[model samples]
Target: MGLNGSIPPDIGNLSFLVSLDLSWNRLHGGLPKDICIHNKLPRVKELQLSFNDLEGEIPLGLGECQQLEILDLLYNNFGGHVPREIGNITRLTKLDLHWNNLSGTIPKEIGHLSNLEFMDLGSNKLRIHPKRSREQSYTKTQGNLIQSQRENCVLFVFTF
Candidate 1:
């Protein structure tokens, strides 16, 4: 559907939704914090909402989707720290938050995600606070502190 306009909050009503891919659309506005209201979306493994105009922080309630594996929110306008609560999703393998306006240090809790292999937080205006790298294993490793920063943006990556 070549739909226009923002996503309806009632989208949370899709209790059985598994993979909600709404990429490359004209969808604006932020995601519903209670998108998984009524304990729904627990079964969701992949949520693809990239290349749109999605602004605002990644919802804190997204942590409720414990089974989320691939969260693609690239090339958008999402801001704020990558929510620390997201670290609770241990099953995530590919967490792509590239090309956005996200700021603040990526949560240290991300190192706890042992299963994470591919993560891209590149091309953002985020800060690379020393604290976020201090406890992370990737930074401790030989030399895995990859910084593919954009024009004046310092995008730090800690992959393990």
Candidate 2:
């Protein structure tokens, strides 16, 4: 489908909607602020808006969707800090926000997501706290892997 334009707010009325994948489209505009209000998307498990032209901050209300397992917004024009409220989604397993225009520090709260298995925030201006032990380990692991192919690899690691 060649869906274009902002996501309509009425779509949130689907009380039982589980997943919303509008990726690989020509969709533009930011997500409606109220779309993720409490109980609006009660059972939503996956929200994929990748490869679109969607711009604006990733809504803070999205954290209200406690059941979200995968949130992929990569390859978009979304800018602003990664919302710390997203850490509230303890069930999130995969989060990919790479290739976006987002800038800011990686929220420390993200490290609390023990269930996160796949996270890619590359191609953005985000940085991690080098003092955090957990982040250091993660950086070292990533750095070592990349260093194997290139002798001089400068790593700017972030925790999530």
User: If scored against the real structure, what TM-score would every candidate get?
Assistant: 0.82, 0.83
lDDT of 1 by residue, 44-112 (tens): 989999889989888888877788898899999998888887788889877899888888876777766
Local distance difference test, per candidate? 0.74, 0.77
Report the C-alpha lDDT of model 2 over 1-160, residue by residue, as the tens digit.
Answer: 6888888878778889999999999999888887779688889999999999999999898888889999999999999999998888899887889888888877767766667767777788787645654432134355322111222323233433
lDDT of 2 at 122: 78
RMSD of 2: 5.6
Off by over 4 Å in 2: 133-160
Off by over 4 Å in 1: 132-135, 140-160
User: Using TM-score as the measure, which candidate wins?
Assistant: 2
How far is 140's C-alpha from truth in model 1 (Å)?
7.4
Alpha-carbon lDDT of model 2:
0.77
**Model 1 quality (TM-score):** 0.82
* Model 1 clashing residue pairs (backbone): none
